[model samples]
Target: MKISAIHLYAIHLPLHVPFVVSYHSYDYMPSVIVKVETDEGIVGYGEAVADEHVTGESWEGVYQILKNTLAPVVMGKNPMEIEKLHDHMNKTIYGAPTAKAAIDIACFDIMGKKLQQPVYQLIGGRYHDEFPITHVLSIAEPEEMAVEAAAMVEQGYCSFKMKVGTNVSLDVKRIQAVRSKVGEEIAIRVDVNQGWKNSATALTALKQLQDCNLDWVEQPVVADDIDGMVEIKAKSVFPLMIDEGLKGPREMLEIIQKRAADKVNIKLMKCGGIYPAVKLAHQAELAGLECQIGSMVESSIGSAAGFHVAFSKKAITSVELTGPLKFSKDVGNLHYDVPFIRLTDKPGLGVDVNDEMMRELTVFHESVYLKEENV
Candidate 1:
């Protein structure tokens, strides 16, 4: 089928509670939604996170790129030629990677619907039916975090991912407090979110944390500091998980060759989408480096997509698609695997977005972006 028209808009889905991380606090997720209309009148939806801090992309910028640059190139082209369309869009701007990413995912979803197969089929053909325990806890005091940790254990969450990066000493104290309370049976992991003080401070913290049995420490330094990460990985006994520093499989390869990071975190937003995510997972498997499939505070739509990626590979060690729990209400009717994250058997990502809920809950809204079809 050929493309008919493209519509780009912003959907502001409110979170049930404020999502606090090391760098920012978010009470609602402001995502740029791309709805592509094909000549057959089939509509496919995709979401791109408007993360100014992580991707340097805003909702307006992502929406404009999808409407003006990407929409024009894809029109009239065969909808099945996703790669050619991806290349055409990529050539327009080497800069707007994240914006390109949102549009790319929508196109793939459209293609999947046309084929009557799930997106996972095109993304390495579903390896596991379900993923392991994926959970996100609030950033509380050492005592409070420990209490939450104990509660999570009771709830059947095996892996506990903590948000750190406040300071070297305090971050250490927080991990230790959880370890003391949980008594080391539960797997403890920390994500600093690019809050590293320096190589020296990271090394100091690593030396003290060797006994904490951390699953991995994420983005101990900035995304740009590849050499610093390599040096830190060399001295530390625990694995160094790279998040912000990576772009895709190619970047992951570079880090592996340089030993810059012992592991890598693959979030759909950062890697563009499942097409590249599967490629990265298979490549990581070939290289023997573990992969961590995480999230960027995505809604059920984005979280379900991440779950499919996690279930696609055995190389994935820990899963973190906990965006649904952070929200007061899930805007979609998707069911994830209990105690872990898993999408239903329903088809094509297997989630239903609630229209009425979105109508009243939408905290932000924007006009439908349209481009000249003949342009």
Candidate 2:
């Protein structure tokens, strides 16, 4: 089947609470939803979450790329030729991995539907039916964070990722309080989001945090500071996982060559989509580094794509597909059971967009395709 049309929706899904990291804070998720229609009447859905600080992409930019550049390239092409489409986009457009990711996921969804197989099986088959999820604690006061951590633990979440690196001492206190409240058995991780200005400060804070038994510390220094990560890794007791520094396979290779990090956080938007993400995970695995499949503040559509990649790969040691859990509402009906996100045997992503919910959240809409006469 060939492509018929592509639709774009710019949506703002309100969050249950303001999500704060070291560098950015948001009360709602700005996302671009992509729907690809084939001539055979199969439709595929995908999402691209806009995070200027992370992926350097915005919802408006993603929408425009999908309309002007991507639509023309794939108008009469086969959705199953994902690689060729990716190459065409790479050569045609300069930047906008998130935009490319949206189309990539939609194409994968179409391919899965055509085969009547789940995306996980199409990618690598299911290694584990369910994987443990890490609950993220947004930046807040020490006491407030502690309360939230305890509440999440009570809700059946065993792993937690705390947004730290704003203030070293206060962050220490935050971790301490959460640890005290949740007891010692729960797993806790920290993401600095490049908050520490230098390796010395990061090392000092990590040294102070040695007693917390953190699962790992992520992106302690600036994104470009590979040397800082190497130094910090040598000095700190905990494993260091790089997030912002990783773009794709080349960056992964550089990190591995430098021996800068023990682990890496792989996000679909950051790496483009599942195709590149799977390659990055394989590279990390070969280099003896662990990987955590993470996500942007996205809707269930983007989260489902991340979930499929995580479920298909054996190298993914941790998962953070908690977007649906953190959002006030999602555009799709998804199953969430605390630490696990269940996937179905249905074709494609196995999730459908909630039409009413999309109508409620949509802020902008656009569609692009060649007319029958033009084609």
Instruction: Report the number of the highest-lDDT candidate.
Output: 2
Pick the TM-score winner.
Answer: 2
Work out the TM-score per prediction.
0.92, 0.97
Which regions of candidate 1 fall more than 4 Å away from where they truly are? 363-375
Residue-level lDDT tens digits of model 2 in 1-375 = 788899989899899999999987888988999999998989999888877877777778788888888888888788898888888888988768898889889988898999999999988899877887788999999999999988888888999999987989998999899999998999999999999868999988988888899989999898888899999999889989999999888789899999999999999899888788988989998999988888887788888898899888888878888888888888987777767777888889888888899988899898987589755
lDDT, model 2, position 364: 84
Candidate 1 lDDT by residue in tens digits, 1-375: 767666555667678767777888887877766666677766666777767767677867877777767777777666677677767777877656667666666666677677777777767777776766656655667888889888888888787888888778888888999889887667878888888657787888889888889888888887888888988988988888988888776788788789787788987788777666777888888888898887877777777777777776889877788777777765676565568555555566666667676666554454332246442
lDDT of each: 0.74, 0.87
Which residue pairs show backbone clashes in model 2? none
Residue 353 displacement in candidate 2 (angstroms): 1.1
lDDT of 1: 0.74
